[model samples]
Each structure stands twice: as structure tokens, then as C-alpha cells.
Target chain A: MSYIAWIISIGNELLIGKTVNTNAAWLARKLTLLGYDVRRIITVPDNEEDEVEVFRDAIKRGVRVVISTGGLGPTFDDKTSEYLAKALNRKYVINDEALKLVIETFKLKGLELTEPRLKQAKMPEGAKPLPNPVGTAPGIWVEEDNTIIIALPGVPAEMMGIFENYVEPKLREIGPKLHFIERSITVKGVPEADLAPIIEKGMKMSNRVYIKSHPKGHEIRSPLVEIHVYVSSEDVRKAEDEINKVLDFLIFAVKEKGGEVLST
Target chain B: MSYIAWIISIGNELLIGKTVNTNAAWLARKLTLLGYDVRRIITVPDNEEDEVEVFRDAIKRGVRVVISTGGLGPTFDDKTSEYLAKALNRKYVINDEALKLVIETFKLKGLELTEPRLKQAKMPEGAKPLPNPVGTAPGIWVEEDNTIIIALPGVPAEMMGIFENYVEPKLREIGPKLHFIERSITVKGVPEADLAPIIEKGMKMSNRVYIKSHPKGHEIRSPLVEIHVYVSSEDVRKAEDEINKVLDFLIFAVKEKGGEVLST
Candidate 1:
């Protein structure tokens, strides 16, 4: 991928460990599959000042796309949309389409539409509405400097439902065509230190391959370390070839080090 | 807590969804108990440029403490210590104590001490070594500009071992004395919009209480929304009293709104 993507998970629950930031992980996987090199996942608390600073900095850092989840509810604390509006220097307005979505969602739930409920419809000016089928709040999609910023609800079901149904189609249409392939090998008795030089050699041999090692000492997985090699390209065959070459080299290196290569 | 802390979870596995960042959640909870306002969790790939830029920016932002997990292994990709050294403009040097610990760990494991393994002992100049009892790599703890930067192993067992044994005690010794209390009430049939006004009133009525609402629409959880009221103070009694006040108000308001209050 030519550009880097980012994920911002906004909520106090995340900071407090009351809620795990699974939204960031899930989005990262989807974006990577779609060929965006996801650079960072920033989990900020539900505060306007912090959100605004982080969001603005992300854009300033030349992030091509940023998918933010949380703080879309109709409470005083849920200010992610508002903070994003300020960050983008856009007015917080009641988008007609988003208002329609909120009204429709409440009707479907047979719930009352109070004045505060209308706050759910407020989004940054010029943002496209991403409708949520599973919840009341509608997501916002804004584009500035050719950078796509998507703001989605915090609730897991609602966030996933909107991202898959509405956001995924938009991304597929605009995102560059790319495919990624990955292969991993687990090596027991070999530390990453011993495996580093061989992995470095593999990196020099391959053009697009990215190799990483995750060490797990003595807990459950018998392997002391796992080496993952990934490659992305427009052609599926090219990606597969690049990843496989690195994986093969690492496996052989593990064998030479007197380590058991667990995964084929 | 008076100071803001952050977590930087490194490694490409986290970004690719091959690994879920349970370490960040675990650290956040631990720091919260240590009386720190855990602010952000940044998950970055194992690239030096990315790591240096992020680590520098975080320090520039004046985070009181930064706890980073992953990338403390003995691999070419493990560059957290090197990046932190560059970020702080300090020389990366091999700490004698850390080298001793690494050599001892290898001896205990009956593993060969390769030259590549020696890289694990290198740390930012003037940083203290937090020994890892469960793994080879010793954690690096550096204090710069009054900001405490801690670099721990990516491996779950090693990371937890260092944090609990060494980092935890240090934080406890230096961190301010404070205690927090949280009381949450689940309300069915009331959307966040309807609860917002009451929550705003509760906020005004208390000095230390912080109220937040989590919406879960038609999920396995029975309640549609859970409003959490939290308070922190040096005095445990003050925190308890403040949380109880908000909890009482929320319960009454939910009842008035014709919503079932699930918690006592």
C-alpha cells in the first residue's frame, strides 16, 4: 500500500479496561485485507479535547484513512462526533439524512423520539451519513485532503453492522486493488535473537515481504517463538510467492539452530 | 489521578489481528488501580521510524508515564529500546546489570548465549533495568523530562512478569495516594438521549463523580443501557459517597422515565 491507515477507538470504557478495544483490531484486519497498511490504533477516552488533538494529529501525520469508533451516543459524554467536527474545522449540524435515520431506527424499535435523541443525528457538515441498521446512531463519513475519516458508533454490534453493510462498500469502491498473503512458522527452543540474522537475510532476499516474530516463553504454546512473514501486491500470485519465500527461509534457519519447526 | 498515563502496544501481530492486545487492557486496569488516569493506547507496527515518531510525540505531549509492551525481544524487528533512545536523544548502551540478567537467564534455561542474544541487554543510556524473572529480556525504565518511560517484553508471560515484579512496586512507591469507586445502574427501555438530561443533573450535583453511559441494543445483555458513575479521591469514603449519590439519582430518574433499573 502507498498510504497508511489508522484506527481510533474512542471511549472511557476502553481506557478504564471496562471494554476491550476489539473494534480497532477488527477494523485493522479488514483494512489490511483491503490493502491499507494500518499504521496505528489509538484508543482515547471519551473527552473532546483529547479526541480533537489525537484526530487532528492523525490527519496531520498524513494518514490516508482513519476509522474511529465510539462516542456516538446521545449523551453528554458521547462527544466523539462533535470533537471530530471541531478537529476537521467543520460545523456540527443536524444532517437531514442522519436525522431521518435516527427517526427511522427509533420507530423500528418502537421507542420514543425525545429532543435529546435528535442529538444522535448531529454530525460534521459535509459528512456522508453511514446508516446503522442495528442501533439508533448513524455514522459519519468525511473526506478532507483526499483522506477518508469514518466515525462509527461504539457499540460492537452497531459498529460492525454499519462498517460491513455501509462502509465496506464505499471502501471497496474507492480503495486501491490489493491482496495480502501471510505464512507463519513456530520454532521451539530457538530464541528470536538466534532467528534474527536469518530473518534479516530473508528480508534482503525479498522485495515486498515483511517479517515479524512474536515470542511466547514457557506458558502454553510449546514454541518459544513464532515468525510471521507477510506480503501484499495487486497480483495474488506475487504476494503468495514473496511471503512463502521468507517463510521457507525462516523454517530452514530454525532447523539449523537445532530448534523444532512446529508449523508446516 | 492527577497525572495522565498512556500505553503503547507494539508489534505487527497486533495490527494484523493475529494477536489481540490483552496486555494494554491489563496494564490500563493495573495503572488505574495505581491511581493514574490511563489516557491512550497506541498500537504501532515494529518499525523504527514509526516507533521513534510516536514515542517522541507522546513525550512531547507530556504524558506522565508511558508503558510500552512488545518489541523487547532479541530480534532484528525488536527496536523499542533503540527507538526510545533516539526519541530521548540518548545513546543506546549495553547496561551491565541487564547483560548479567540476560546471561543468567540463558544459563538457567540451558540455552546457548549467542551474539544476537546480547542485543537484549542494550538499553537507553541511564535507564534502569527491570529484571524479568520469567523471560530473558530485561525491561528498560527511563525517566526523561519527568515522564517515566517503561519498555516491557511483548511476550505475555515476560511482560506480565516484569510489570508485576518490578514496575508495579515502583509505581506504587511514587504514585499519588488515591482510591476510586464505581457504581453502575442498567436501565431498560430508555435510550441515552432520554438519560442525558438526568446524567447532566447528576454531574452538577457531585464534585468528583464522572458519569458515562454504554448503549447495548438488543444484545445478550438484558439492559439497553448501563450508566456508570465513578468518583476518585484520596479518601475512600469520599469516593464511595460521591458514586452513591449519582447512583441514587440515576435509579430514581430511570424509574421516573418508565425504565427498569436493573441494579440496586
Candidate 2:
């Protein structure tokens, strides 16, 4: 079974240019490394309706796992948890474990837990609270109809803390069996078309080999074309062998065309 | 009227972690700087069904401008233009201007225009072709029922070129009359709870003031709390005065409580 995951990055700071969203990219990289196919990464503002719509859209697309970052704080704009609960058609309740974590966090910081801070404890009914070792807001992990929905705080440190502590382990348990290997060969002094025939020949030899070309540098200058060879398989050894064969052929082909392979 | 924009980043590389999605972040920063409220940024794999669903979803959310990047190439995976046409129920045809641009681009590179390469010319009927001066793929600009949809090539350089050349001008002409201003003050030598009352008092005096506390550093040391104040309004002068009043009070209160305001 092929596992597909969707990412929803929720915040107005991202949309308003007040802050940069490194969360989606970081998560995409992590998920890909973990053998889960990140099908989509969506950024929605703090608006409840838009957040809810994105969640529904991911579900409709048959995403088995949905990881949402941001808007799980005590502030009024942090509406991700509420919208998520509403989308799942579940009532919002303060999970005891989340409440305990919040209280402990406040006590450690020597701060009184205010009403707004208490709001962080509220989660969707039947949701499992993922402990946030770094912050007061606990990440919520909910399972519905075999789909896993994880809600983590937008703060980078807290998000990472929760993911490492709870989400990562759960992901490994349920994730699909997959392996991917990639090799990129940078060719200089050769147009992409000149290398196309070689790439076509290589791809024809192996069904697992796929090639993509990217032009590098300014339009006026001699563009460097980097060809990426991707090989994916359930067996790691087979995937690596497929990638190695394509790389070997690509290097030879570039030299045959009187072009140098700058790097691989 | 407040304007809301939606960003749709399309690619399969994003899902598999082959590529980090820098497009969404860059687009968000640009839209925010242009004073447009970007409501959502969604990343989806290069799937026709997902593309169509996302387009419809963005329209239903009443977003005035929808900017989608990627899948405007000649490959089989590049189905965004066709799906966009099917979703809008518009006819699909080879836009003459776009075809000319593609042919001219290939000719400049001295590359033979293959059948797949020529496929870049086809676009949704009635859509305006936005010039991609740097690349072969041209962006498509479609306006339907007051909502504008822009389809740009996935290549980073090509997307930026088309957006800067065509889309930005059109967006500036029809955007909303709204502005956002933000200021942050770092408070040292005090816990957040003690600072909350002072901030609350300041907020009660000024309706436009918003205070957010961010804790920094690891668990072993005392975390630094930085408070951010955001003031948004159509009238710049009024908003500035409101922000200044709160800023002055916050500084005074922090000083009285034996805490220093690092900066404003």
C-alpha cells in the first residue's frame, strides 16, 4: 500500500510576509526521508473557514495522513484546533493530558495559567494529546476513518519537539513500505536537447529510471543543465542499483557528447 | 474592501521531498508586501483531480485572486491547464501568442521543437498569455466572475519572471484598500504573567493594540519573552498614533515592574 501525506501550514504571518514558512519545507523533507509520500503542502491563513476547507480538501484527495502546523496556541488568532474539531464533526473538549502539560509548563515558567492559556488544552473529542516538551500547547493526534490528523503548534521549536517525541514514532508504525534513490548529474557546455537522446536511451533500458532536466543560470549565458535520475522501489538494493546504472550511463554519455559532467 | 488571495503550489517533487517548496513562501511574501491578504497556500501533487478540486475550492472561498504555480509544462504530469479548463468549463485551445512565445524560446536555444515541447502552447480558451521571458512555458491569466486565476510554470525562475512581468501589474491595479503594520518590543527580567497585566492595561486604553508573547531559549535557562504589537487599519495616521500610544505605555509599565523594553 502506498502511503500519502498532506501538510497544512496555517498562519496569517506566512500570508502577510510578517514571517517565512520554513515549516512545510522542513516537514516535507522529513516525511520524504521517513518513506511517506508527501502528496501536498498547503498554507492557509488563520481564518477558520479557509483552514476547515483545506482540511476537507486533503481528506477528499485520499490523504491517509494530514499534518498541520501553526495556530495551536493560546492567542485568539490560533484557531487551528477549533476548526479541525469542527471539520471532523467532533465536539471540542479539554483533554486532561493536554491540560496537565499546560499547567506544568506554566508552573515551570513561574507564570499563572490564564483563561486564554487554558484554551490550549481544548482539543477535539477522542483526540490523543501529544506532549509538547518545549511549550505549553500540546499537539493533538486524532484518527478518523483510518486517516491520521496531527495538529502541532506553529512555533518551530515546539513543533519539532512534539514531532520527535510523538508523531514520528506513530508515523513509522503506520507508514508504507517504500524506498527512493536519486542521482543528479550536472553537465556543462551541452544543451538539454543534446543530452535528451542519451537520457531517453537510459530510461528505455530501465523502467525504474526517470529523468528530469533543469536549466541553471541566466538566459544570456551558456546554461548548465542538470539532469536528475530518480529510482523508486520497495527494495532498497534494487532502487540503488537502478540509480547507479543510470548515473554510470549519464556520465559516459555527457563525455561522449564532448561535454564534461561537472558533478554527480 | 479587504482582499483575500489564495496560493496554490503544484508539484509532485514537493510531495516526495525531491524539492523543497520555496515558491509558496516567496509568493506569500510578495502578496503580503503588495498589501494583499493571502488567505491560503496549498501544495498538491501534479494530479488532475486534486488540481480541479483545489481550483473550485479557492473560488468558493471568495478569494479575489488565485495564484497557482507549477504543472504548466509539456510532460504527462503537467495537467494543470487542462484540469483548470475542465473545472471552469472553458474550452481548451492552443493560444497563438503562447505558441509563438514557446517556439521563439526554443529557437533562441537552437533546440528542435518536439511535440511534447509544443504542448506548452495549449491553454484554456479566453485566457491571456502572460510572457515568460526567461523560459519556454508561458503563464495563463484567466478572469472569471471578478476572480482572477493565474497559472504559472513550476520552474522557479520562470514562475518569478512571469509573475513580475504580467501578474503583479494586474494585481496592483485591482487590489483592496487595506494596510497592516507590526511592531515588536522585547521585555527582559520579568516573567510573562507579570507582563500580561501591564499589556492588558495598555490594550484596554487602546482598541487597536494587540500583544503576543514569544518565549525563547532552552529549558535549562530562563526563557526570554518578546511581545509583539500589531496594528492594522485603512487610515495609516490613525493606526500609527494608536500603536505609539500603546508602545509608550508598555515601555513605562515594563520599567516600573523592574523590566526593560529592549526595543520597539
lDDT of 1 by residue, B176-263 (tens): 7777677788789776677889988999988678898887666322447888877667999867877877788788888998899876
Q: Would you list the C-alpha lDDT of every candidate in the order shown? A: 0.83, 0.78
List pairs with backbone clashes in candidate 2.
A38-B15, A41-B43, A43-B41
Off by over 4 Å in 2: A56-62, A106-111, A191-210, A252-258, B73-76, B105-117, B189-220, B225-233, B249-259
**Model 1, which residues run further than 4 Å from truth?**
A217-223, B217-223
Alpha carbon deviation, residue B246, candidate 1 (Å): 1.6
Model 1 lDDT tens row, A87-176: 999999999998888788777767777777888888889988898877678888998875889999888888899999998887877777
Location of the lowest summed lDDT over 10 successive residues in candidate 2 chain A: A214-223
lDDT tens digits by residue: candidate 2, B1-264:
547788888876776666666787788777765668777777887788889988987777677889998887655557788899987889888999888888888888777787667777888899888888776778999987767899998778888988888888778777655466778888777655456567667778777666666655442245466777776577888888888888888888888988777777
Question: Every model's DockQ, to 2 decimals?
Answer: 0.60, 0.41
Tell me the lDDT of candidate 1.
0.83
